[model samples]
Target: MARQLDEQIAGRFQVGQRLRVLDVGMGQGTQALRLARAGHTVTGVEQDTTMIAAARRDLAAEPEGIRDRVRIILSDGRDTGVHFLPGSFDVVLCHGVLMYVADPDPLLAGLARMLAPGGLLSLLVRNGDALAMRPGLSGDWAGALAAFDSNSYRNRLGLDARADRLDTLTATLAAIAAPLHAWYGVRVFTDLAPDGAEPPADLDALLAAEDRAGRTDPYRGVAALLHLCGVRD
Candidate 1:
């Protein structure tokens, strides 16, 4: 569910709020377009000019109905002065962007500063806790633990990714006094499955179950990575 994620985001919006939204490291304006389509003005900050060009071209090619809703600016997320102002946006998103940054702490601090009072910070990142799930499930607990401890999982970019857990993020957010809200496991079961593996009947059921589990108690502890939606207090 892409639609589920969209709905979850849209449900957070309120009409006539003149909401300003910033997408950190926005890629091709995926979430940006969705949020803009939902009537919230969106400004996307991207570091790559090529991506910005492509996003601009794509937006221009749209049916003129959704074309001008999103603004794409080329800038680094850590210091996106193009859109960064003290307490500017109502919602700030950092989806799938944290994995690329070598140091997330400074990026997080800047993001926290950009939030307006009661503004939502939505983060989507790879689940660090799932690093050993496949090995453990395959009856290789020792190997799993080793990889987990060493942080040797193959990231989506084909490089090593150090997964951050809920505890780590919670502690980080608490340091800023940001109030935490609901979190979810996105693509938890699908990501670990083999590429092109057709969803088996049982696996389909399992995926749906995991979606709920990833949002609930106990099971969420083992989720790939948790989505932390917090408000700046």
Candidate 2:
């Protein structure tokens, strides 16, 4: 996951270029800190005050030089005002956030609006289509079928939380005139492991194999989620 993140961030940056980066739903500012350290100016938009405070404290704890390159704003992405100009950023990152939203179209539109011409948008969405692939692959046919047919894997706030698929997300991006490049499966193997259970050597190899499988056709359909990137036209 970290390797994939580094690659995605690197795509939007050139060394020594004073670029602007926006990390919407910037939980803890992990990506923001990375871009800032690479010499890009970063603006993180997050609505949760507690999360904002923690991010602020984290920036304070960083070495003085890195902290100065980043700024955090307490605002939702949809409403960040003239504080940020359109076409101001080189990259816009939205990760693991669409899952909580009932309708992602608005957020998608908002990100598209913020993206500069030829600028990149990197998105990580929960792979709804893979919800049942694991249990099915693990030989639990009943549980697998249930997850496959259900709208949600688990109930949230007495409601179902729908998962997303690469096709649906790609369509959303296309609506914004942003075409996607090759996408890869993220967390394809590690997520299904028993928590805190270290894998044996053979199992490690198997996990790596599955990760590769999750990147290919047929197998990719069952991955935990997908990551995609491209630029607005």
**Which candidate ranks first by lDDT, i.e. highest?**
2
Least well predicted 10-residue stretch by lDDT in candidate 2: 151-160
Relative to the unseen true structure, what is the C-alpha lDDT of residue 1 in candidate 1, on a scale of 0 to 100?
34
Reference-based lDDT, each prediction: 0.73, 0.76
lDDT of 2 at 126: 72
| lDDT string, candidate 1, 43-89, tens digits | 89998788888778777776665666677777788785445677888
TM values, all candidates: 0.81, 0.81
Root-mean-square deviation per candidate: 3.4, 3.5
Worst 10 residues of 1 by lDDT: 1-10
Taking the tens digit of each residue's C-alpha lDDT, what string does model 2 give over 106-213?
878778778788887888777888888767777988878888676465532355566787788888888887778557777666656665787677976876776577
